[model samples]
Target: MTTIEVKCRFEAKLLRPAKPGNDKSWAFVVLPRDASEQLPRRGRTTVEGTLNGHPFQATLEPDGQLSHWLQVSRELLEAAGSVVGDIVTLELTPVKKEPEPDIPADFKEALAAAPEAHKVWNNTTTLARLDWIHWITSAKQLKTRAKRIDDACDMLASGKKKVCCFDPSGYYSKAFRAPEAENS
Candidate 1:
């Protein structure tokens, strides 16, 4: 197993800005671009670190605008007793591998029933498989999840490697989303 560790120490402001027409603000801590460039990979990376003396494990994601950031939920912020503009300390180390998302039971059955699709699915890369699972699980409604599973099997059997119209990196995906957009 190979391990790559990148540590960043900086003072960043915790900003809570609302998206246009959303009337809700999101809090996030932006990482400096230089620090971001030192990470092992872009996109979602499992990270363990400390924020204002509170330990946390989270996936660091790149917002389209910020390059990379940690979305500080209310619970996490409160745990650290952090407030906006406070200079919080961050020490992060990337995990060697990202764990796979759990496939829903119905989706597993759908794949099993389609041997051809299952074969193609078995041959897909781990990242590709993760994307398929993420797309299906991101559906907020049961009907949508069912439809995605069917669509996924069909696409896989047809030899498609990726979920159509889905952002596998999760920049715009519901599974992992950027806190805010510049065009907001």
Candidate 2:
């Protein structure tokens, strides 16, 4: 496997700002071509060394951004007397992408049913409906994929237009159980 290692300084803005002490951590973005050899799931590979004398765990996002959730205490930040402007070094070792999940047929039917709106949505690339399609279709299981579709339909039918807030978890609970396989 080919691994790309990058050294970059985190600007602190990438961290979850809502969480306290998040500014002390750093985020490393990675794009792994293979689907099964990524970090975190396999085991801890020490992606981040000591940062301001504190330890941290590197978390991988679905978008391929590796985030180091620093274990630094608030007292440590106060003692070091540093704020968001402080630079933190990050070393990212590329892994592999997870396998793309399969989308259910019902979900595809739901998308197909909105042919006119789907056409309109496809016309507007700025709205990210295509990205939503990609995300929804990536589910590996039939039930999961159908749930994603139902959630997406509910959101689109409501005239919200944006698919980012559509939660498949809720739909999965109510629908999408024991669904038949979808033809790609």
Estimate, for each residue in 1-184, the C-alpha lDDT of model 2 and write its tens digit.
3333533333231222333333535222222323214343321122432344454334233332222233334454454454444554333443333223333566657768976555544444432554465557657797887787777776666555666743322232231221221222
Q: Highest TM-score: which candidate? A: 1
Local distance difference test values of all predictions, in order = 0.73, 0.42
For every candidate structure, what is the RMSD over all alpha carbons to the true structure, in angstroms?
Answer: 5.2, 16.4
* Runs of candidate 2 exceeding 4 Å displacement: 1-63, 66-108, 115-123, 166-184
lDDT of 1 by residue, 1-184 (tens): 2335667666677877555245443467778877766676655566777887788778777654425688777788889898766778887766666666567798899999999999999898766777788678878799999999999999999999877797645546445555553332
Cα deviation at 62, candidate 1, in Å, is 2.5
C-alpha TM-score for every candidate: 0.65, 0.31
Pairs in steric clash, model 1: none
Quickly count the clashes in candidate 2: 7
lDDT of 2: 0.42
Residue 83 CA displacement from its true place in model 2, Å: 46
